[model samples]
Target: MVELLTARGCDVIATVGDGDGLLAAVATHAPDVAVVDIRMPPTHTDEGIRAAIQLRAAHPGVGVLVFSQHAEPAWAARLLAGEASGIGYLLKERVSATADFIEALHRVAAGGVALDPEIVSRMFNTGSRPLDRLTERERVVLDLMAQGHSNRSIAELLVISERAVEKHAASIFTKFDLPPTAADNRRVKAVVAYLQESKP
Candidate 1:
């Protein structure tokens, strides 16, 4: 990864073994962008992304390009919990395409988005948007969800059982691929996805 990036004129900063070290290096050196992996030392679950979120808050000027083994909607949504500017998420496999990777890096550094092809396709593909996966009833529940309705509220609004609304919301979340995680706000992310797909 270092060789691929350096060959394209990206200055190689310190590479650390843990997320804390990565955050510290960025704070110390303050590079234009930081390439972070999703998993790191210890848990290897979401250390890198958690660090990236911290970096986003601590240093808004520094862009974050998260590289992960898979293009997961859950992680992608978590990374994009707030602003989308200066954020990029790409599958590790996409790095094999030198030009694409470099372009994504540059775009993120310049406060633009550069999502992986598969993610982008899943997001914006005509007739195949992620929203399409939801059933009609689930779509209604999601619309209520986007409007800040709780499961009980949604149930009341729709004249259904709260348990039914919960089931529908859970189905909505699953279909949207926004998995539950303690580190990330799955509800807010779900609304973001809902609103994004709602955009014309």
Candidate 2:
């Protein structure tokens, strides 16, 4: 599959046998995107999905496309949490059609989000929280925070001052009912919550 993708003009930077290998590839190559099998070897019970989450946390610029045989909405929720940029989760069957698969890959690479239709439908069956309390800018900042961006980076991206970013983050925490805590610890908790509720 890697050879075929490269042959068709897509740059296949690395291929690995398992989730650990996928993490190592991200650390070494730092590719623009990752196309991973959700069922990787060595106790393949959502290891790929976990690895994708870790990768997103560590290197938000690197896109990830997870391919699975089943429509697991929990995994999708985890991946979509926080920041939704450059992420995709699709069934393995999608790869059978070259054009559709390649288009999905390109979409994620270009920083657009994509999820399989089947997965999307399944997510609706799961209970989700109401995120309507957050304003659009707050949501954007939250996503960036989940991607492991610092306040300064977020401020620069949003063209706001660092102090303003801090205020917005505090407001987000208040709206979410998150208690006061150390900044780093609070950030981690926020990301976890975001992932847990980010399904549909």
Once model 2 is optimally superposed onto the true structure by TM-score, how far is the C-alpha of residue 45 displaced, in angstroms?
1.0
lDDT of each: 0.76, 0.76
Q: Check candidate 2 and list the clashing pairs.
A: none
lDDT of 2 by residue, 1-200 (tens): 88769877988877898878889989999998998877777887778888899999998999899988998767877777757678888889888878878887887887766667676444334434524667768777876665446799999999999999999888878776789854435654554464467544
- Candidate 2: how many backbone clashes? 0
Alpha-carbon TM-score of each model against the true structure: 0.64, 0.63
lDDT over C-alpha atoms for residue 190 of model 1 = 64
Q: Write the per-residue lDDT of candidate 1 for residues 1-200, one digit (tens) a residue.
A: 88888899889988888888988999899999999999999899999999999999899889999999875656777777676567888889988889878988987898766666566444443454667887878767765554345678889989999999988878877877988876545555665674354344
CA error at residue 60 for candidate 1, angstroms? 1.0
**Candidate 2 CA-lDDT value:** 0.76
